[model samples]
Target: MYPINTISKGGLALVLAAAALGVPLAAAEPDDGELWAGAESRIQRHRMADAVVVVRDALGRPVEGAEVRIEQKTHAFLFGCNIFLWGRLPDAGMERAYRERFAALLNYATLPFYWGSYERRRGEPRHEETERVARWCQQQGIVTKGHPLAWNNADPPWLPDDLDEIRRLQMERIEDCVRRFTGLIDRWDVVNEVTHFDRPQFVTIRAPKHSAMWERVGQIEFARQCFRHARAAGPHATLIINDYRTDAACERVIEQLVDENGRRLYDVIGIQSHMHGGVWSNAKIWEVCQRFARFGVPLHFTETTILSGQQGRGRPRSTPWRSTPEGEARQAREVVRFYTMLFSHPAVEAITWWDLSDYRAWKGAPAGLVREDMSPKPAYQRLMDLVRGKWWTKLSLQTDQQGQGRLRGFLGDYAVTVTAPGKAPVAKDFSLARRQTNRWQIVLP
Candidate 1:
């Protein structure tokens, strides 16, 4: 048997006792449609306090639909995917093998609208591929997040040549892309990486093709303009200003954005968490996340991955993290540790993998949950266990105040009951799992 990490005696007891209870556990139900409608419809309705609280009882069951004791909510997890070049370009054939992998892993698919990739040639956008992916994602009941509608890397060759054409062309591209994928995507990242602290802003990396839109338009103004344009073309899309490095400056810019008077440039505060320098201590991740929680904008752990055993720095880098079985096993254990840690965080809404497989992963790190062959890795199974296998279960609550029982938990189907309160106790089951578009539902009252 593979060695599992150590846990507290109490936690270990929860696991062992549950395993011993093995008496034909109920098969976890697949999600149903119209279930998350309340949540989805409210996406554009509220820009602030966009999180939910998670709680549990003595029993180790994931409870759902618990009343918010606190006005502030911290949605346990809002699942997502980040469209990186490694996920798309050239070796996408490898992606074809793992279609089911992505379909199951994400509730939202984030498409990066790099100015160069979207409109490699003037007046010619990658409309075919964009529509193809967007439509498919919608059919699968997956909400869409269009990344970086405005970015420094978004400049076309013609854009940098003439300053006079920057605003006109930038606006035109934004309009075209937004219109092209209208209504299909629910959220759009208006800007990405605007703050430059220790690292350079996008313009520095893109070089000679830099723009006045980045330097002169001002990050906030650019974000506002992009959000306005995106809204004009695609109504009801949540706008976001996503940044990588979580420094004080980044926090300031995000705060400036969410708190602005007339222009609330961003709806969701997108934060990236690609921790390749070994697993980050729990405290570190929490510290960064808590800051975003202050702004009251729902937080999305936008683009994230933990390398198994790679060596590289930033965008242009090298080495695969897991080339052997031991390495692969280590990668798997890390995935569980990282996921369990993040899932427990209140502020983190979503955690997206840059790629589903290493076939075309940026700098080729074994960061994917599965292998290129579509085989399940330890990481994949752990995710399946959480995301699919045990999405819903029965929970027990010991009564607290006023003869009423109170407990905290996740968003999913749950059955709760009292064992020894009044004469003979009572039980209540709340089927709260989000309904799926593909499945049929018959409500039982």
Candidate 2:
């Protein structure tokens, strides 16, 4: 496992106590600016590993001076965007552009499974549509995650008024989705936004029927039941409890989402950061990481939105928001910074951008990495530079006298080609991850 070099809970409490008492704690901690400046170093220390590639002949003789080429294929850490536009674009050209750009940059795709839209009618869900998208994602080597198996955000219009029946159907839906997509999509946001499931604003106006059903079942009980059903269905799946709030409210809900045996139900903790209002400060981002790291589960920034438009004050639908040149520039800079911080933090395993394009983004806000016309934004290019260029590893090396070539590179899937003088080129694929031994042997033909 990758070591987390952050302060422990006890140490953090001591630091807090010292601060409260106006006492100095050994050395001062780095500020936000310092953290940003040192992000690259942190990334190198945490996100990379060293591997020794050994080359030999079929007779087990060391083949010294062999030329070896290493190239990265995919990231173990998921960088994703919602594939809500998979085949839903306006035209074939737009669809083609979307697929090309998405596959070029991202190795993770979030498939939409919103209850209201996914299954508009009872007993009939959009399984074929979702399967088509999942198949495409598999073909492109992208990991697929279903967004929200359970949420009070919206309910199907065909939902029944009986609370008991609603609960049964909800659990059945969770199990069905999890069981059906077991291998195709092994990750899920099991229960979404339970911290504010019955918030007055949402319960009254947004999803009254769903909220009422959730209330009757009780918040913690609802989450517990949903997680249990999901776990039973997809035992090997990475189930997550997702929430928008980063405060104590979220922590409370997560703390209580345990089985009868006191074991946590979720495999990951999903945090939503919709920055349509504004980008979160560096300090806030780091604080969120620290807060969630205590759960001992990987953190997935499930639905992140860094808008490439002027910040508006009213409701998203009511406001006329458009992406501008200046805003795109700022978005590019901040996107790099935000992603770097998250990537540097050890607890964060994945980061999923909200929308891939602004064509039909949530709330009609301009929050896509690409524009409405399927053109790349500055943010898109800058992120590509980081994810595929700077963070990616490509190298050429010669084996030493011991027939070993050593390299330190970012942890991910890699392809290696070894060519010795007067010998056929030999190629092999390997993966570099934290938990596994990274040594590989390539026997030349």
Candidate 3:
């Protein structure tokens, strides 16, 4: 466990209040010197808000209905995991199983756009296959986002070694993706891992080809340019500058992008919490959110990974990782705890697990929600319980004399059913989008 360097001042007070109400808050002091603090305070009591919907007759008059049922088909919270390997599955059955697990629990998905893989040969991109998957996700009512439009590591193999050409090509790549996917997959990671450009890992030691590009154009400018290009290509897209860094330096990069009028360069802040080192302490997680919340932009846990396996030897990035029952149980608990913290935080809009299955997990670490055999691990079951069970909304009620049905629920897409005495049942579809009243006036013929 990492030491808790920062703590939210209000957390203790909130915890005390919850304790006074007889709510049990679990706080564990892990052997790794990390304190999982304020678990109970993080559990939000008011995730569902009041939504008033009125059933009306065709003539715009309120009509009493015998039965009213509201079923949430998807979440607006953006529970997502990467589907990078979904198209690569050799076995059709395995692919179906993977898609089933994904569609069952997730409403948002991250598709791979690593430049090298997306366009292995110059001038030829596998847009047909990519578009095919995007359409499939749309059919399932799932929103899709391209993993990265521009990255230091997303270098195509066939590209020339010239630095200027690389820079030009990078911008072109961003333009191509945004133009091609446009509305189908508008949200994008316009630039990834920019903070590490000047770090030793990138500049001096084991420098990737992107380091030269970074050195030439300057790190921050390159990122800004990427966002500009992506925005130009997909004017309505949500562009984000995603980084693995969560410290003050990362915040400064965001701060610098703001102008005198306090306008932000990116629409969303993408923070990666790949906790292969260990699950972040509740204090650290909360603190990070508090710091980034100052930016006044929605935060997305863009590439999250919590290992269900033993710590690897030597450096944090290790291979051939193995999973154990004990590790799986620990992983499950942390998943619930951390997710609760993120969901409760007012600034967080999305949280996406880096990879979906352990078989192809980065560096072979057991960081997947499911096992290689496609069986869900304890972590998967626990996540499902939270997303589809505890946090889900399902209701059956009747309209009052005014033909108004009062109800509250988590925000998202919903399926509505209306029935009247001696009349055929009517089915309708509605969405409880962000803001507004979420109130609807459904008419019966």
Candidate 4:
């Protein structure tokens, strides 16, 4: 999609998660019928009970005899499989591939940054390959976005000391990439974990020159800088200022996004909630989503982890931990809860898990929904329930003569049973609505 992006066999293969060499999915069948049906049922019966999608002519008058297509704004869940940070995970190539597959199931792919590994080799940037995967995701009807453009861990060692130079370089990187991949992806996490920059190791490996990020530029100012420049690049992308603390720091960032002077700098408010032994409980996520809603911007739970183990990518390389059966089950249950919450939250628009399978998880976090063998983990089922089980279910819809069908459904796939009055009920399939319009070409028999 962009000149800067390069696609390779590495990202196309599941080999990174050991997903390649053979199988595609786990043991469960891929009959998307059930999931789509259930998800649609919720929309038709639960959400749109009082709402109506009336077909109207160009004159804004109802056309009864003329076939009608009811286009209603229905609530549906948006899901993602995470692309982990580099060095924390060894394969940059596979990062793109896994994200491509993630696009296949969910609405979009979420990529985290490992600025160390990204710029580790100097002049050569590691983003192109990932950018290639993002392009591929677009081809596959997947929406893609990065985790952070500016974060504590995103700068390399050779950064310039001059604020002008740093700003120029950072903006250059964001602009170049954004302009390159503008059409492929529309959203980005402009920064990450923005308020907590006190970590020793993160501070230790900083570039020799511009090591003082917060000191030189306030977090909000830096965030605004990122947003403005990235916006200039894509011109059509949604820039986000993201952070984490399990506290009120995120609120401050929200204030900046809504500030009279600084408000134009942001499009979405991103949050990081790694459910490390915890779950994104439906009620809790609904509450967390409220903060962003106060500012009237959409929300994204950007970096999420529901681990079945005790270790992490940021681990000190000495922690002792392992995955347990109970832990795996809990992880699965938590995942279901997480999706339920995001789907239910009025303002929460997207939810991205760190990885699909545990094979290449950052530092071996047992947070993958699938195992290395591509076998279904309990969490996989939890997610599959949303994708193919609930959201992607196939169901029947009735269409009028104009090739338009109306049905009670969620925001996904549907198989409409079109009967020509006395003709057989010929079922035609079409994917429902998502970030963009969902349309299908039907051939009548």
Candidate 4 segments exceeding 4 Å error:
1-76, 84-104, 198-200, 205-210, 258-262, 280-283, 310-320, 397-406, 412-445
- What's the CA error at residue 360 for candidate 2, in Å? 0.9
- lDDT agreement with native, every candidate: 0.56, 0.87, 0.78, 0.57
In candidate 4, position 353 carries an lDDT of: 74
The parts of candidate 2 lying over 4 Å away from their true place are 1-29, 313-319
Q: How well is each residue in 158-180 modelled by candidate 1, as lDDT tens digits?
A: 55566546766777777887777
lDDT of 2 by residue, 1-445 (tens): 1212235344564445344322234444456897788788778877899999999999999999999999999998999999999999889999999999999999999998999899999989999999999999999999999988998877788988888888999999999999998899999999888887887877887678888888988889989999999999998999999999998778778878988898999999999988888888877787787667766677899999988887753444655788989989999999998999999887788999999898998888889999999999999999999999999999999999999999999989999999999899999999998756699899998
- For model 3 the local lDDT of residue 378 reads 97
Residue 28 of model 1, lDDT score: 37
Clashing pairs in 3: none
- Name the best candidate (by TM-score): 2
TM-score of each model, paired residue for residue: 0.67, 0.93, 0.87, 0.71
Greater-TM-score candidate between 1 and 4: 4
Instruction: For candidate 3, give the lDDT of residue 202.
Output: 51
Off by over 4 Å in 3: 1-46, 58-61, 199-208, 259-262, 312-320
Order by lDDT, highest first: 2, 3, 4, 1
Identify the candidate with maximal lDDT. Answer: 2
